[model samples]
Target: MIKSLLIANRGEIACRIIRTARAMGVRTVAVYADADAKALHVRMADDAVHIGQSPAAESYLVGERIIAAAKQTGAEAIHPGYGFLSENAAFAQAVIDAGLVWVGPKPASINAMGLKDAAKALMAEAGVPVTPGYMGEDQSDERLKAEADAIGYPVLIKAVAGGGGKGMRKVDAEGDFLSSLESCRREARASFGNDVVLIEKFILSPRHIEVQVFGDSQGNVVHLFERDCSLQRRHQKVIEEAPAPGMNEATREAICAAAVKAAQAVNYEGAGTIEFIADASEGLRADRTWFMEMNTRLQVEHPVTEEITGVDLVEWQLRVASGEPIPLRQEELSIDGHAMEVRLYAEDPASGFLPSTGRLDRLAFGDATRIETGVEEGGQVSPFYDPMIAKVVCHGEDREAAIDALIDSLADTEVWPVRTNAGFLVRALDAEDFRKADLDTSFIERHGDDLIPSGEADDAIWSVAAQIAAGDDQDELVGFRLNAPARHAVWLSHRGEGRLIDLAEAEAIAFEDDGDLLSAVDTTATAYADGDRVVVFSDGVGYAFDTAVRGSGQGSAADGAIFAPMPGKVIAVDVAEGDSVAEGQRLLVLEAMKMEHAMTAPFAGTVKSLTVAAGQQVEVESLLVEIEPDEG
Candidate 1:
């Protein structure tokens, strides 16, 4: 085995690689950008090196810097963990040329599946079932439109080199084709530096199921079964599971077999995933499933597969890269049980799933089957990277038990101040449709409102907040009116809304310390006092309220000013000063965490001042534009 390995990535994957490498007695080197100097992965590694500045293009994505860091640290191999340079064919070749073992497939395999159009053509030639689409060399708009017209309405316009749902558009009719095509191409160029695209017939009810495949340097390949990644939002997977629910023996065998075939066709090596899109309008069947794409590296959801198959994929990658044969064959590998994984992101579901950044004041989780995370309490979730805080995984004898265990695990998860999808995930797992496995890519969208209800505090919550404000002086009777029979009030703010609760009239009260429940209500709600804010963990969600008197807290921004919802770079300013605009008109676009978010006008108005320009970085709540409300 390789003695020392360099992880060419950051965040959870880097930390994950470090765990397995150290366990195998391999020294590990972690490379970090300036922003990740204090990251958890850096502390876990045997040695650390600074690559470049905070921006990925200046650091993680720079192949030369990574190579230099590996050589300086005397790393015998480099593991491109999931992202950054993981799928870059040239980077793999460069590493091999430097006489360092690349813990991945040969460069040829990466190139074969790098672009969607080319990869689809290759898969077709290899006899892997592929979706019907246009993969021609025609770049003319008319030809592309004709192809889409032939493919029929509701076609998908996807970037040839895109991943993570970027540079993809679904056009339902000819009227929207041109505009959608332009938008898709623009995003494609921005994301992948390639404007080429491919059009596919969009499946009405698509389910994303990917098979985990591994190959050794000796030209042996095997699969670790399949995972259902159908639960998605914005085309990005939110949750994933192994031994796909509702999968029959026939469909499972066919999908797994196709995955193995695809891997062998390219003479694949190391760990890779073959993703398929199944038209579930008629349920999962071999013929309904078609090759969507292949991930040429370890995936973010690899843990679920590990849980079900009792395999350490990272260890397999190391051994294979060291010239070992495949550890298990198709007949030897079999699923043990059901497993589920949910990505706990630092994002607010109520705020359109916008990325949130802050110091993690409190972060905790249950005794999950496995938990992979890169941040701890007091850790900074910087705006410079993906907002995923942790990935929680659980396993059980079957799918229902796994779901039940996952829900309890989420309930045990506690996060404060920094918003999360914990509450949402629990609801999603507990949903009647979800429990029955009625899943698809549109699951989140179909039940978004129910999953992400308005963060309104109930009376019981207010009662708890009021007790915390009174402090630990239980000797003094809270809200005891000595003079007259009048109700005493306490002011609290929650979810940007303030409330004045009459403490003396509260129905029930509760206060606890160190898991002790002291209340009339028969419920356990853990709460603690943090400065002027009272933090509480109740019913699978975390809440914090500022103890303020009425009229003292900060109010919303001025009526006409458009505040930056989060810190990001201004990518586009659509209107000039004095331009008339209607309500909800897109005025500016901000790029943060590699995602574009549009800022729209709150009401019909004339632009009074446009203070920001393209390429300027703005902090959260910084005023970028101000409009004069139209005097109708």
Candidate 2:
């Protein structure tokens, strides 16, 4: 076995690898950027090394730096946890060339499946079922348009080297093809350094199903069943489950077999996943499923597969990298029960699910579920990396029971100040369609209204905030004077509404009071105050209210100034100082947490000032531009 290993990643996945390594009596080395010096993974590892600056391109993506760190720290192997340089074929070769064991598949395998266009042709030639589309090498825009026309309308323009929905676009008609292709290429270049693309027929009701396969140096490969990742938002997976809810024996066997065949065809080794896009319009038919792509490393949602199969996939990766054969034979592995995993992110569901960054303040989840996290209460959710807070996994005897457990777990979770998708996950799991196994890529969109919580905080919630502000004292009538009831009014702003409530000194705030005329508030609320800002937890959602004080907590920016919504680096400034802009025209693009957010003009105007330049790092609410309203 490899005596020591270095994890070339960050967050939960890095910590996960360290845990299994420790259990196996293998020393682990952790690498961190400047922003992650105090991160949980850094503290958990046996030894640590500083790589470079915070940005991944400057740090984690530097293959030579990682390899040198591993060698200097005496690590015998390097584990590139799922992102960054994990799927980079060159990085794998670098590790091997440096005499360090690469804790992933061979570089040849990664190169084989590196690009979607090339991989499709290879899979087809190897007898794997592939979707009908254009994977030609023509790089001309006119050729792409012709291919889309040939494939018919409603085709997908996808980055040839893309994952996690970064460089993918869906076009419903011919008129939208060029712009969509441009957007796809731009994102692809930004993400993968590749501008190549592929067009495919879009499956209207597609169910994303993937099989977890493992291979060893001994040429043994086996499948650990399948996972259903149908629930998605913004083309990214939101929830995943093992032993797909409505999967029958025949479909399961066929999909798993095809996955094994794909892996064997590549002569793959280590942990990998074969993702299939299943057309579920008529339910899961083996023939309707098409090969989408292969993930050359461990998946973010590997815990669900681990839960049902009673296996530790990370340990398998380590063992295989250390030259062990497949842990279990094909007959030995079978689905045991149902397991579901939901990705909990530090992002606001109300504000277009923008990444929420700040102090954790409060992060808690139930003990009944498995929680994989790398952050603590005082940890910061930086804009330099992914905004994921944790992964909550629950298992039960069956699908319904597993979902019930998952819902309960989500309801029990509490994250304050930094917003989260907890409430949304609960509502999604409780949706009738979800409970009935009616799932597809459009699940979230179909039930979006129910999932997005109302922004307005109710009277009861306001009362709870008031009580917390009043020190939670039930002995004295709040704000009451001896002569008369003291007129103490608390001003709060929530969801664009300013609420003013008067507190009577003679009446105590009761926790059990119903929302009647006198007690129109539910008092069983959790609240904490940060100076004048109070955050209350109610109905599985966190509501933050700013105390309406003069010169504080007002609307963002001046009348003509465009302020940064969150702390990020200005990647592109689209307007000049004297440029005229129309309403809703994008003025700049801010790159935060590896995602791009466009800042647009509120109304037609002329640029009065451009405060920040491209590549400048700004804080939340920092002014980026100032506009003067056009004189009519």
RMSD to true structure for each model, in Å: 5.4, 6.1
For 205-243, candidate 1 gives per-residue lDDT tens digits of 999999999998787889999999999989888999998
The prediction achieving the highest lDDT against the true structure is: 1
- Residue 72, candidate 2: C-alpha displacement in angstroms: 1.2
Off by over 4 Å in 1: 477-491, 495-512, 515-524, 548-632
Candidate 2 matches the true fold with a TM-score of: 0.83
Instruction: List the candidates' TM-scores in order.
Output: 0.86, 0.83
lDDT of model 2 at position 625: 87
TM-score of 1: 0.86
Give lDDT tens digits, candidate 2, residues 1-632: 99999999999999999999999999999999999999999999999999999998999999989999998999999999988999999989999999999999999999999889998999898888998799888989999999999999899988888888899999999999999999999999998899899999999999999999999999899999999999999888999999887788899899888898899989999999999999999999999999999998999999999999999999999999989998899899888889999999887776778787867767867544589998989888887888899999999999898888888777657676567888888889888999999999999998877898765677777777665554443334233336774456555665434555554521355654322112214343456676767777754577666664322223423567776666678999999999999999999999877779999988899998898889998755456887788888
Top candidate, metric TM-score? 1
lDDT of each: 0.86, 0.84
State each candidate's clash count: 0, 3
